[model samples]
Target chain A: MYKNILLAADGSNNALRAANEAIKIASLSNESVIDIVYVADYEKTKEDVLHASSADELMIERRKKIQNVEKALKDNNVSYKVTILHGLPGPEIIKYANERKMDIVVIGSRGLNSLQEMVIGSVSHKVMKRVYCPVLIVK
Target chain B: MQSLKQQWFGNVRGDILSGIVVALALIPEAIAFSIIAGVDPMVGLYASFCVAVIIAFVGGRPGMISAATGAMALLMVPLVRDHGVEYLLAATILTGIIQILFGIFKVAKIMKFIPNAVMIGFVNALAILIFMAQVPHFIGISNMTYVFVAITLVIVYTLPRFVKAIPAPLVALVILTAVAMFSGFELRTIGDLGNITQSLPSFLIPNVPFNFETLQIILPYSLALAIVGLLESLLTAQIVDDMTGTASNKNKEARGQGIANVVTGFFGGMAACAMIGQSVINIKSGGRGRLSSLVAGSFLMFLIIVLGDLVVKIPMSVLVGIMIMVSIGTFDWSSFKYLAKAPRTDAIVMLATVIIVVYTHDLSIGVLAGVLLSAIFFVVKISTLKVERKNSHYIVKGQLFFASTDGFIDYFKSTDINEKEITIDFSNSRIWDDSGVAALSKVKDMLRDEGIEAKVIGLDTSSQKVVQQLDGISSSH
Candidate 1:
């Protein structure tokens, strides 16, 4: 039973599929809880802050990235808590998973940007390569 | 220990290769910035080597490169022009001291105050400045100079597509210099600018009188240099952090830049800071550790010592073309889109920053103005004191500051309150300064003239305290 499941969500369609997988794994054990992690890349802080009317609006923008996944999780009755991490998606996800000694990580095979993934390798690839726990890649 | 190892030598092959590439890139830049600062090319070269090497061990950002930057050079033009290299060296040392103090005092906390618009403006302004400095070298000099420059640009921009082993700028330098030398083309060479001593830089005190007069002469320039140097350094570090998805010790970097500049000054070199162009080159080439910076600095010295004679024979037009490339790379071209898409105030701040820096040729002043302008815009944005009426009661919201006080008074002057007893609520808003309280008193007087008794209620303890403390309000109570 994957008791401590870490789900990486980025509002991508693939991430919703990953969340469904996380719910499947988490429901196996009564003690299990899927920890939903959304990483807001620091690279966009400048543009995001400039475009946003206020700090509240900036948070709303970031929250929108995980809104779909949260709704899916709610519909499944999966026990979960959302945590926002700041930095690069792949490395920060890896760091968070390792630090918490996550029993398993469930991430999507692709994210919002295929071009970035193609150029620098995907976040899932980096996470799968670096994370110490078992990683479930939902295509 | 685990993370330190990861930070230093996480990728060896990448670090060294990138380091070498960065070293090659630094040469033309170091020499070009030297000429811009009006010093001998060796001073800039020595400063780049010293700053890069020292910053590797001591700097807060591991992957970021620090060396003789054009921003610092632009700041130095007046100093070097007025009192010569000795005074410039003196100013460099003093600049280091000021930076160290800034680090100790944790000035890095204020970096968030620099909005993105201003940052884009700063980058674009610096790009404009870099291009402006290179104008006289190749402009209308000769048809030959123009040809060499065009060829250099072509090679630098296009060669990277075919060749991945070497840096494009170095390739441009080598190929163009060889053609000019072997073909005996009449060109303005680096040698024509200034004599470059082939020997290594040595420790020597600046030959300026140790008196108050000397301090008075260099202090202003030193302060300006320190501020601009640290600003650019911190900005570059932030860029590197975003690129690598890692955090940096910014305060430590401030001190490290100070230490590097101090050592560089003692070694008879001008002040230096982070070079963004070279830094991006390092990142793209797979540099991810302090070792890359170490290699970059040491390898630059190696190149200089082994190829000093060859360096002098290089045509200045090639350097001009490369610097033009640098300016192109340094400028945030997306800022054009940003101006169209961004808020009006943000656009103004960015444009103001660019125009002021380009006009004054002083980054510190330009940045100061941008920060001040942005601050004013921010205050104006947040101080939108809203007075919403719900029947006989008025609810006040948002910050009530001096800036919004006049508007708060005007709201009362314009509105005709029909209620005999109108309750003004201050529960949702906080009053700041005496002007806010004075505005409240003026509102009460205006409402009284309208034959309406304003019953003030919902005052938070702090707002009540402020209202009671005002002289007229105490008598009215």
Candidate 2:
């Protein structure tokens, strides 16, 4: 029965599953609202700026990365808003979660950057270690 | 703000440990860069201590280490050799003033103009330069020196496999210095470079006349130092930002560097900037805040007070060995594959950057040449004005800028037009400048001479405005 929920999504299939899980938990409360937190990592932003031909194209690409989670919220008639954060995904998500004092943080077990995760521990794992709220990591 | 507290103290234990490691590594380098600049070794050490501490509070990039660096040292050689240390101090002050102006004007925005090819070349050049400077101590030194260098290299490269807590370079330094001392090895040491004074650097103006003649003497050198220092610092800041997965206020870092240099000049020290090699060491050792840099500066002084005697005895061979490891780590070895797979133009830019810097011993000039060559290539590629002919419709299908205007005329002049009337349509392209409009009118006149009427059509609003304004004046010509 969480009133304040943070859904960390990146439009991947795992993120879609996590979004569904967040929606199920939010339905149990009368005034529950969800915040969809999408983190655009600094390295990813650098690569994208280099590759994209125009600023508008970069914005469109970024929007596409979190489109699925937004679609899920709209279809469920859920009261939700999307917030874009920048930096390392794990630390940025945790900082936002702590600052907002969320009741729970629902995140995917796996992310889009598998190679990077292999090198540096996974984002969800880092979030579970540091975030001040309950973390529900859906596989 | 509460964020300031988080930035300084959020990771205290990790910061302190990493700072100590950086302090240990900074010792050999500060001494070596002083020898390169032809100044007393204490000058470089003083600058490193002052800059690192000041930038910890004033700089925009958290966790980045600034110090007396080889690039800045290379630039100071002529000034220090020609006028003396006092004049060099005056130049350092002027350099700081110029850099503050650059920061206020927000020079960080220009960083985007430096392409990735140039950056790769700059990095490779730096690594090569670092390696090259160690050659004198590396070869023909002595048989004993060789053994110590080999052992230091081994310990630096292989120790991380068994040890993760302490930095490899620190271990190499401590263990090799101990063995060299006890074994009675008669080898080159840091003391041969210069003496490291135990007392703190006192504040005093350089003993130089404050006049127009003095300004004239130091201005050129000061300008060179300012530009080179800012370029290296901003580039280093960008690298640290990428490594730490954060963004930095590059303009603020510029101003902070100015503050550091200004204070350093007054305190009998040379100008300095951020060091990429030490920064990578900082990051690898888990440093991620202002406290790390503050501790690095403080502990460097602390080490000199307590261990100054032993630090001067550090065998040059051991430092050379550690530097070799640093150079190997600094180079982007994957760039070998990058040369074969990347575009020929980019590859050429990268190579030109390396060759010019290595040959001229000037980082700014090489970077300038690379940027100019890349820009030339970019201009040539973007000047393609595809003029298509479908029946009597001549469609200009690319940007009609100054660079493309010559090609615009050449396309029509070389072709044989057998139509009585033809339409030159700007439906697909926009006219950008006066040269484009003049070319259009010139082509119209040339066609008119052949008894053919050409009508221009399909101009976008802005392009139409440009053409209409320049059309009558240029057609009269």
Best by DockQ: 1
Fnat, model 1, is: 0.03
lDDT of 1 by residue, A29-53 (tens): 8899989998877545434444444
DockQ of each: 0.13, 0.10
Q: Which parts of model 1 are misplaced by more than 4 Å?
A: A1-139, B1-14, B379-386, B389-391, B433-442, B445-450, B457-473
Clashing pairs in 1: none
Cα shift from native, residue B399, model 2 (Å): 2.8
- Mind giving the per-residue lDDT tens digits that candidate 1 earns over B9-54? 7888999999999999899999999999999999999999999999
- Candidate 2 residues lying further than 4 Å off, grouped into runs, are A1-139, B1-17, B209-217, B242-247, B280-288, B341-343, B378-384, B390-393, B455-458, B470-477
Q: Give the per-residue lDDT of model 2 (tens digit) for A57-133.
A: 65678788889988998899888988877566888899999999999999999998798788778999999999999
Q: Give me the TM-scores for chain A across all models, comma-separated.
A: 0.96, 0.93
Candidate 2 lDDT by residue in tens digits, B407-443: 8999889989999999999999999998888889999
